[model samples]
Target chain A: MDPSRLTIAQASAAIAQGSLAPLSLVDSYLERIASLDGELHSYVLVLAEEARERARALAAEPSRGPLHGIPLSLKDIYWTRGRRTTAGSRLCLDFVPAEDAETWRRLEAAGAILLGKNETHEFAIGGPDFTLPFPPARNPWNTAHYPAGSSSGSAVAVAAGLTAGALGSDTGGSIRGPAAFNGIAGLKPTYGRVSRRGVFPLSYTLDHCGPLTRTVEDCALLLQAIAGHDPLDPASADRPVPDYRKALERRLDGMAIGVIRHFHEADAVAGFGPENAPNPAYCAAFEEACRTLEKAGARLVDLRLSPLLDYADANRLIMLAEAFALHETDFQERPQGFGRYAFARIGLGAFFSAADYVEALRARRELCREFREATEGVDAVVSANATAPAPKIDTVPLWGVFERASYTAPYNLLGAPALSLPIGFEDGLPLAFQIAGKPFAESSVFKVGYAFEQATPFHRERPPIAASLPGRT
Target chain B: MAEPIPPDRFTVLVERAGLKLTPEEFEELREGSRFVERMKESVRRSGPREARLRGVTRPREKTAEPAHIFIAGKD
Candidate 1:
């Protein structure tokens, strides 16, 4: 059996049934990483020896849970005790954390083996920067293309089959954007759903830690292991986490799904430019995805709230204000320590006044209220995740993020659960759409995403890099 | 429409932010300020017109509060 190709659920089941040994699965991924990651640049550090030791140790014990023996990577921003956690900046090349991030500690206790640390955009806010200590992760579909970041390596690792799953933090569209570009399943759980303690902060109010996996079901399994409140995280939700996997069986029949077509077809384009319009192929794929959901007995409703730019601007302002505050000392003491992208992007925060930050906070409240009221009658809302497939890496301008209105940022502002799953392909690259639910309504989002995933083959399709492997072909 | 921060003004802000940048980095950030101006414009345009018109001195509806709130001593 090829353990490298199995999803987290399948590998867990195999390990539980005694068909797949934990060591073999870990070895499978390590070997794949050795063969592929040189060009992909997905991992900043590969824990081959540590992973093998852990796998052997787990092999001696009975199954711990569904994630038992599963190998996964984490974005470098997540602190792993005694492991170098570089947040992709040269400033912390040798910095090591004294303790594990709450999320990583939970994953470890659940019997999942850590394979490595994935690369991230510097401080999780920078663009793909060449000046960083590590090279930016390239898309698996085509090396020359961009892998939407700062969870760039997490999505690349999963999509390239280097790891069964990865944990990533999302502020704005970090998780969902890369997931869309890589054609994997990425979830940005409702704010405070997962503990962020020990993970480097981008924006205190907007950051969320979640899973990136090959399929929606795998995403659920990973989320189950990580979700819940952590007292250490002041913002962690105190609510109980539902059985996300079992909830996946819930049908989409008779569910009300809001389709925000204007987000991509009009608002984003009007705000950016004609070049920012979603590709025709992407539009067709989104239409087909809507049809697939409708066929699954979901009722599609056209919904509109605040313009996309409103949410985008608010999200950006808050993120910048908070991020700069956190990194101000670094920016001042050693401005040259930062990569060019991180330096310039975070520097923009200094231009905004104290009143601007407070205004953004107020705007956030209004946008959230508007979203909740508009989505009151709907179980979930669907929209384009990325308007186009990954573009040439160099073509992306340093200020490109500011130039476009993100379809994913509205959910970030609302602190809602949003999932990005593959819908189709455009020009051999992946195309994806997002399904967002009310705050803490990940189950509804999963139900809608799973329904569409099962009806389409997009999730099952592997990137060319994965397919080109000798036996995989 | 919002105009980008003037170069002299941008230089002062950058200096006040305590970031010492190369001329190249400064120029890049100066160019990037246009987007910041545009974003500031959008944010200024958001929220209730009554609040903005009153210059934010008027009391807002009781239930309308900032998204992030702090309750001192509450955990």
Candidate 2:
């Protein structure tokens, strides 16, 4: 495989064996980023010299870890010491943190090379705002379509082979949305599984840090390097960090899979896409994914919980309330610093009374309890991540987030582990389904995601834009 | 959905929030309030009414220090 196309594990193995030097790997990616990122807009800032210097240093040393010599991009929200962390907003264009985000520190310790800062939805809740200092990431599958965000650039980088894997934070499906849209694997680990210290806050209670990568195993590898307790992060889980890559070795045989069929089927509000009718492709792909699991020795059971709208409502209220709290002063003082979509979305928070915010929290507990009770019989729940493939970028409305009920939001609200993996495609764009597990049961989520990845050939199909890149063998 | 917050009340809330939205922006927000109203209704419907009442009716325990700050997935 071309160096850029190689999974983290494959590249690590090659690098460890000295067949591929870290410098060469970084160079290959930099070359590809140079060639593709102009069109893809996957990176906001390219730290070419820093990346090359880090790669050269790694090339001289023995492997520090599985992530040693690997090149990765951080969503611009992750504070990198002395590097501009724009959080995809013009307001923070000059902002640079003196310390690295805990995840960034951990990855750097694992010998990962910094590729650049990937673009994001402003403050992770903004729209695909073109008015921001940086352009929104273009979907590598089809440049004209929306790469579901706010981890837009992170997914684009991985899908287009601009970076090996990228760190993406999910407040409400940001990581998984882009992963699904771009045809890659995205894992939003159980809340607090990865520390959020030094990452710009989106929703303090709801935000989750995770990864987007080319494969389930790669996702596990990236998570392994980043997941740990940080004393500075109040929500950081102090539980023992499991060997995620080793956990991937386990088979999915005999695992009980709960299929949340109604979320996407009946409740999903199709927003921008031309297809208002039920997406037959998505329906067929989801059914095929279930069959793939069954063939892999997993038992599929139909499971229903609270209506998707209920979860969406609770999640939106909490996120908006919390995000507004975080940026309230700024929103008041200089609302012009924010993009129109971000301002409009965050502005909704102004109307929510303290009673409303508290009520949402109470409702959150109820919904989470329901989900927990519903999933007790099953190891994980499978559902469509997005209603369809990427929509036209311009077609996404400013109110789209409020207008739709997400398959991914329930997991966000539950603070559970959810993985979005490509199942198939429609109109040459990827379609995905999420495997959600109980809080802290990322092992189960990865097991199911890996089994599905192995049984299907969807992961093997690269975006045509990437395949057509000159000099790619 | 809960009845739309009257424009006068909405204006007060925006002023308290210190946001300076133009009339055009406020009009757009007025339109968007329908979504928020629907969401508020859903949350209210879903909330545990008894829990809220109990929270208000039975507030006794007072601690000098905050509750334990254990993280999720940890003891």
Candidate 3:
């Protein structure tokens, strides 16, 4: 099998048994990035020399673990010791941290090769704004379409086979948004499930770090290396890390799956404009996906919680307010350093008074409780990953997040484990849905997502860009 | 329809955010202000009827000491 085409499980088994050389594996991915990244723009930096050196070093030693010799990318927001960590903003473009992000440290300790850093929205709040120092990542499915971000490059990298997996931090749909648009697998582990120490904070409370990969099982592999208690991260949960990969083999039989359909319906939630509603193709695909799970012996039940806008409003208030607070000094000092979209969006955070923030937090608590109660009987909850397929890059309106409710934001609010993976295609673009579990229930989320992934043919499909590349597909 | 934040107040808020934008940048942000207004209004309309003095409870209890505290998830 082409090194780039091998799933993490396959490649890891090959490397563990010495059938595949780590150096050659790194070379294969580097070559793929060299060929496809010009159009994909998935990476801000390509540490080719360093990656080769790391792979050479790993191949010299006995296998360390499943991630040993695996090539992975980090979203630029993660602080890498002695490496430029630009949070996709010109500000701090030359900044290098003295210590590595906890996630980076874990991956490196597990013997994963760092291919480079993926691009992200400025400070992870900036949307796919083009005026940034680096070009925003384009959708691999359609180069002209936007790859939803701030995990933008991470998703594109995985979707285009530029890397085996990449790490993305989700505050408000950063990981899942890009995952859906790029037709890959992304996991936003429960907040505190993965440490955020050394990663740029958008909202300390809502931020989650996880992986974007070609398959759900690969996501579990990446998560295992990164998920654990971190004393350095105040938010890190002190909990036993479940064997996520082992959990993937569990069948969904007799499990109750909660379906959140109101989120995709027009009249069900106010402020969700018609354009923001899930398209007919996506709706049909999601229904079929539910039925697919049903055939797998999972019981599907209709579930409702608070309206989607309630979660959206609360999440936006807390995120922007915290983001504004973090960047206040920088914005006040170097306003010109930020892109227009980021400045406008983060600046709006100033309008949120302490009272507004307090109220939003209170509402968040209520919503979280509501979500817990609503899903008590179910093992996992599923919903449309994105309201619609990726729109053209030129058509993504600035501040569009406020005009529509995000199906993914509710999970962030509850700090639940959420995974987004390709379900099917709509109008030639990828369509996706999210499978989420209660806080700290990533194993359950992975089990459901892996079952669906194995039962479907969507993961087998590659982007048109990949088809055009020589020796690809 | 919810009313947009008034232009005068919006201008004050922009300065308060410590941003000094060019005329073009300021105008662009002025348009974005409508979206911000909607977001604030949404929160206002959806806020819980009663306020909690202590604010939302921390989803997890912090460790008494600087020790790792792990919350076990159900299988």
Encode model 1's per-residue lDDT on A201-315: one tens digit a residue.
9999999999999999999998999999899899998999999887785358779999998888777766666778888898999999999999999999999776677688889
What lDDT tens digits, residue by residue, belong to model 3 across residues B16-59?
76677788877776776676665665554432322211122232
For candidate 3, the lDDT comes to 0.84
> Which residue pairs in candidate 3 collide?
A238-B69, A238-B70, A239-B70
Docking class of 3: incorrect
**Over 4 Å off in model 2, which ranges?**
A249-251, A269-277, B1-4, B47-75
> Could you give candidate 3's per-residue lDDT for residues A393-457 as a string of tens digits?
88887867666568888888899999998888977899999999999999999999989988999
Worst 10 residues of 3 chain A by lDDT: A266-275
In the range B1-75, model 2's lDDT, one tens digit per residue, is 345567998899878878888998898787778777877766665333234322223231232122123467743
What lDDT score is found at residue B32 in candidate 3? Answer: 65
lDDT at A160 for candidate 3? 88
TM-scores for all predictions? 0.96, 0.93, 0.93
Q: Please give, as one word, the docking class of candidate 1.
A: acceptable
Local distance difference test scores for all models:
0.89, 0.84, 0.84
Tell me, per candidate, how large a share of the native contacts it keeps: 0.65, 0.49, 0.37
Task: Give the fraction of true interface contacts kept by model 2.
Answer: 0.49
lDDT of 2 by residue, A83-106 (tens): 889888879989989999999999
